[model samples]
Target: MIVQDQANDFPVGPEDTSASQATQDQLHKSYRMPDEQARDPALHIAKDWVQKKKLPDMSNITDPQLRRYATLYPKLRLTSDGTLFLEEGTGDDQRLRLCVPAALIAEVIRCLHQHPLAGHLGRYRTYLQAKRRFYWPNMHKHISCAVEGCTTCRQSKERKATKQVPLGQTSTKEHTRFAKFYCDLVGPWPNARGPGTKKYLLTLQDAVTKYPEAWAITDATAENIIRVLTNEFFPRYGVGMTIVSDQGRQFISTLFQHAVKRLGVFTVKTQAYEPKTNPVERLHRTLENVIRCSMENEKVHPTQWH
Candidate 1:
């Protein structure tokens, strides 16, 4: 016979020995025992001992659940109305946690985990909250499974760590000062100045000596890049044995390629989306910081960046 609590619409009676059709349906949906079983037999036995103010005789208790209760007898408590509780802590910090049966374990966890105030906390936090109010065998394990299986958590929570391949070294032992160069373009600064009101910077760094250079230009076109490399850079530094750059349009343009080829310089482009493959990328950050600090110290407006 099933006894229902009208006020809360919850099942309060122990389950009948024969499973009903509704019970089977609920089992299919949740894979848990029916809600009709509010009291486990093991807990009932423990409650009897608690009410009588005596310890249970565990020697003959062969049932696994009953044996489990026997082991927890020291912390078990019973109320006058037959409700079972597990006592935790001592003295002023004492707490009585309701001993929940297997049938209602899922419901309890669902309410605690999905509560608006609870805000769908992770496994350990949900376990801590459940532990404060309810007691059950392997409570942490149950809560962990519930939290892990939650669709909302799986969909919304970001992974704690992302796997990535280690960065490959770009320099070799045979490299020397000015022999290999890493080059990139930086900005269209909001503040434009100098001849042609230059607003962009073309930066280059030596792989071996770590030497760096930059030139301001009005645009990052292939023509401007070729002019900087052929007329200024190659003449001063001599044609680099090799130059590493990103796959930007200015660097990959036919004009830029032909100019480097004629100078007898081998050009290598870094892999797409892999900035670390070009060492000059790191120099950009330091360059920006130094420029910003110098401008502030000299009270020079960024328009004079050229």
Candidate 2:
């Protein structure tokens, strides 16, 4: 099939009419190949001239041709660029302006018509309708996808606002305000290397200041705990307003109570089975964590618990 070049390629050589048969009357004006031009990338990428022509009147155009055009230019799918019509913007919407240029629209039409997926245009058309339908609604509303032939963001990217929870438990009001303090014994952790060789930890924490006093023991009897608590720690830190402790037999025993009553130091005990009555228990949890983490690098320190 012979291809017809653009009608306005050059002033169609004024129809030559005077040549005789013997003079070999040229059938058409001689068309010369254009002189080669250098390839300028920028020239190819330049935007097309502004739209000026009236939109085409394809009133008699068959659905088959429209379908074919849609294949070449998806948005304006045309079988060939030459077959394109100048499009007009409707009001200020210029919705079609968001689409590719008439040239590309023409190519989209061309591809669509000839594409093996031509039968699937109805689905695509539904999507195109959606893009136009949802994007910029109610004047300022918006919805669109950034992919080829996508109506709803190409099946859309599912994004969820990340609900990040703060990392650790937050503190509430301070449990006490002055020099009141807390103390407790944490362990007689069974010896890993041998039994009957007991190891235990003692924690003494200030209730008001929240500072800690720590000690380690070979055993956790009431006598041993009170002896060291009164003689050693109190002298240095001064008698606290109060001491809160777990319900160990030592803190409840007569000997331990007598020592506190004589010294005028008040004693508070955590309710049986409730460790939190002693806020120092929280610090104990931290110390336990420290021990656990250090265990990976070194064996649990038995005597250095303080």
Candidate 3:
């Protein structure tokens, strides 16, 4: 059945409030409020509607396309002449539309001069860019970074980003005066550029001094590190009272621990898998900055950290 503004087609003239089958059906299904998935209350409503077969009211629905749903489900109900909304459930909260519809969100945005949560949205974007495997907005990948909901693309569409871990570790670099140290190994850098059978950089940092020391290696075997400490590092600095490094093979080797014990030096490694535990991580950042600064300032790549 088709409805029109003219009473001739709808059969209900200005005098009568009564409506034709087509007019009532169209009005009933025309309510096209967006389903908000991020809001728990909103998502709960959508979930209940979809799973339990509780459909929205279809009376006086103004949207022509959505009115089609009324034809599909006769059980759906509607009221308000298309203004307010009410539904029935055992509980007051369940029966009510706890969430504002997507249409309402746009309306709110339009009415308000500024949004209260707008400042926090940039941080959310950064988080989305960094991590790509997160199940943020439950919708299918509809937006870049986060397409879960239009919160970007609400309902039926979502783009997930990765999850970020909260390791929450930092170095004592800021507190001590050359007291804390961080050490790590970098590279089995490919030997294609220059024909070295093996190469690595054993990096060390002074927490307070912010000074970094690099020891290049052609071989990174555990024995090599023990030998380096005995030969190069130990002789100049003496054994540090508390040294921090990662759980790499060289650091964890029984030989390294024994050597430290024999030297009467205490050793502390970073929390397992937490890179920030070592102050030297900052030094690595500095080194990268230096490389970048040199490239920009000098217009030539500085030699790689040898």
Candidate closest to the true structure, highest lDDT: 1
Each candidate structure's count of clashing pairs: 0, 31, 28
| Local lDDT at 174 for model 3 | 64
Q: What is the TM-score of each candidate against the true structure?
A: 0.43, 0.39, 0.38
- Model 1: per-residue Cα lDDT over 1-306, one tens digit each: 012222212122223321222322243365322222335676767776666767656798998877877788888765433456667787766656667777778877876666533556678877877766567788888989998898765654444565898998753685567888899999887667456878889999888889889998889899998888877898888874898999999999998899889989999999999988888987776566446534443567768865
Alpha carbon deviation, residue 272, candidate 3 (Å)? 1.6
User: After superposition on all CA atoms, what RMSD does each candidate show versus the true structure?
Assistant: 22.0, 28.9, 21.1
Worst 10 residues of 2 by lDDT: 18-27
| Per-residue C-alpha lDDT of model 2 across residues 1-306, encoded as one tens digit per residue | 011333432212223221111111111133111211012221111111112212333464345433333332323311122212212244554322122222223333322222322211223442343233111111111111212343322232232466998899866556755457778887765342344453777888765577777776667888778778777877886664677887888889999899888887888777899886777887766565445433422444654333
Screening candidate 1 with a backbone cut-off below 3 angstroms (N, C-alpha, C), the clashing residue pairs are none
**Predictions in order: lDDT:** 0.70, 0.45, 0.46
Better of 1 and 2 by lDDT: 1
Predictions ranked by TM-score, top down?
1, 2, 3
